[model samples]
Target: MFCNKMLELQRVYRQASLLALITIYYNLLEGAVSVWFGAGDETISLFGFGIDSFVEVISGVGIWHMVRRLGRGETADRDPFERQALRITGGAFYLLTAGLIATASASLFQGHQPQTTRWGIVISLISIVSMQALIHFKTKVGTALNSPAILADAACTRTCLRLSVVLLAASLGFQLTGIGSLDAVGSLIIAVLSFWEGREAFEKARGLGCGCSCGCTTSTKSDH
Candidate 1:
């Protein structure tokens, strides 16, 4: 019986580590595109897009830490450290979200509309779509594997996908209306959504000690 548990623990740790590596790699690519096109177009949405990718880097690190602490043998018996990391990431997400919204809103208020770049548009479109597919995959894999890290990774991906709607809207709005302010408004909306989702994750992580992803197998005090 103990052997089986240890084997499952090993599998979960490996999967979480894989997830972390993938996310970080994608984030780096995202950051590069955002920087290359953002300044040229002077678009807040595009620039903030980069920041959003970088933000996920922190979340990925948290998951990595969780995987490491939950590693082999004796350490496996210790409580999952990922929950505390999730709480911290959740709070940071909210704070960063507020900043994203404020900056976008302020830009809109100031009537700062930016020109769009073709590369930026293409990347954003591809990113949003690709992430949607990944989100679906994560959902399935996490459910099947029943790993908190997998679940948390999916949740983060979903959050980004949701925010992409606002981003796309702002991008198109600016393109059509010749007003950059729409971009800012879009950013503000993203911030609100981020805060709401982040807080939800925070509460779930704290109270349940789970990533709020489906199919959790962890035991609680009441369960014992």
Candidate 2:
């Protein structure tokens, strides 16, 4: 009976590891596509969203590492590598935020308009569906394993979902009204959220416990 339980635990851990890997790879693809299309279409919101995905890749790598350690029956405490990843992720997010804010401000000031927001609409729709599915599966696995780290990662994905929604709204609004400022406004919102995520990453790295907007504090407490 005990051996059966152990095998089950291993299987669940493997599933968690697989999910983390999927998140990392998916973000890479999404980021690349978003950046390419965003640049082609001159959509600041989509471009900023793509950069955000790249930052998420860094965070996803840390989650993958944590899963590996936990699979080995190690403690959930943030290790040196995870801490470093968090710091890097935080810095990247901050940089992205600043860039987006600056670019968005300039675009607004110049009354710059995107060539097209159709791609933004398409990308955001896909992201919404993908993030929702990931959240569902991650939450299921986290719950089954009673793993706070996994749950926290799942919570983090919600921020991605929110970004998608913002992108979609801005894209759709611009498409309907032929208003260019909508895109810049969306980029500004993304910058605000990215700034918040950066702060959360730094806090996590410092072992301050989760005060993330994603409501992960309840689950993350177990990690501390």
Candidate 3:
């Protein structure tokens, strides 16, 4: 029974690690594609969304490290490496927020429109489906392991899901209505959410909860 239990736990840990890696790689691909098309098409929202994915890669690294430690049965406390990664991720998110806000405001002021939002429509749909699947699996694995860090990571993915929805709506709205400001409007919304994410990252670095509904904060407290 003991050996079987250990084997089962090992399997869960491997799944968690694989999920983390998938997230990192997927973000890299998504970020590259999004930035390339966003820049070519001059779509602020898609551009900003791409930047967000890059930042997420940094955070995913920390999660990957944590999963490795947990697999070894190490203490679940926030390690220095994870803390530093969170700090860097937080700063990157803040910078992204500022840049997006500035560009979006300018675009709004000038009534600038993208050449076409067709790519945004396609990319956002893909992101929406991908993020949803990631969230479900991450949450499931986190539950199996009872790991707050993993659960919080799942919650963070929810932000990506929301961003995808915003992009999709703005892209579709513009395609249907020929409104130039919808894309900028979507960028502004993404900026706001990015700011919130930045704050959450900092909070996590400081040993506080991410303030998401995932109950990670409560779980962290209980662990102590």
Each model's lDDT: 0.64, 0.89, 0.86
Q: TM-scores, in order shown?
A: 0.73, 0.96, 0.94
Q: Which one is best on TM-score?
A: 2
User: Each prediction's Cα RMSD?
Assistant: 4.7, 1.9, 2.2
Alpha-carbon lDDT of model 2: 0.89
**Tens-digit lDDT track of model 1 for 1-224:** 99897687677566656766776788778877776687688777777777767666666666566545544322322244556655766777677687787777678677776777444467668888878877776666566555544565676677677666667777777777777677777667766766765665566565654443222334322110
* lDDT winner, 1 or 2: 2
lDDT of 1: 0.64
lDDT of 3 by residue, 1-224 (tens): 99898899889889989998999999999999999999999999999999999998998898889888888888877789989988998899899999999999999999899988999999999999999999999889888877776787788788889989999999898999989899999999989888888888888888788422222454442131
Supply the TM-score for candidate 3.
0.94
Candidate structures ordered by lDDT, highest first? 2, 3, 1
lDDT of 2 by residue, 1-224 (tens): 99998899889889999998999999999999999999999999999999999999998988899888888889888899989988998999999999999999999999999999999999999999999999999999988888878888889999999999999999999999999999999999999999989988898888765523243564453432
Which residues of candidate 1, in runs, are more than 4 Å off?
1-16, 67-84, 117-120, 204-224
Best by lDDT: 2
Which runs in model 3 stand beyond 4 Å of their true positions?
210-218, 221-224
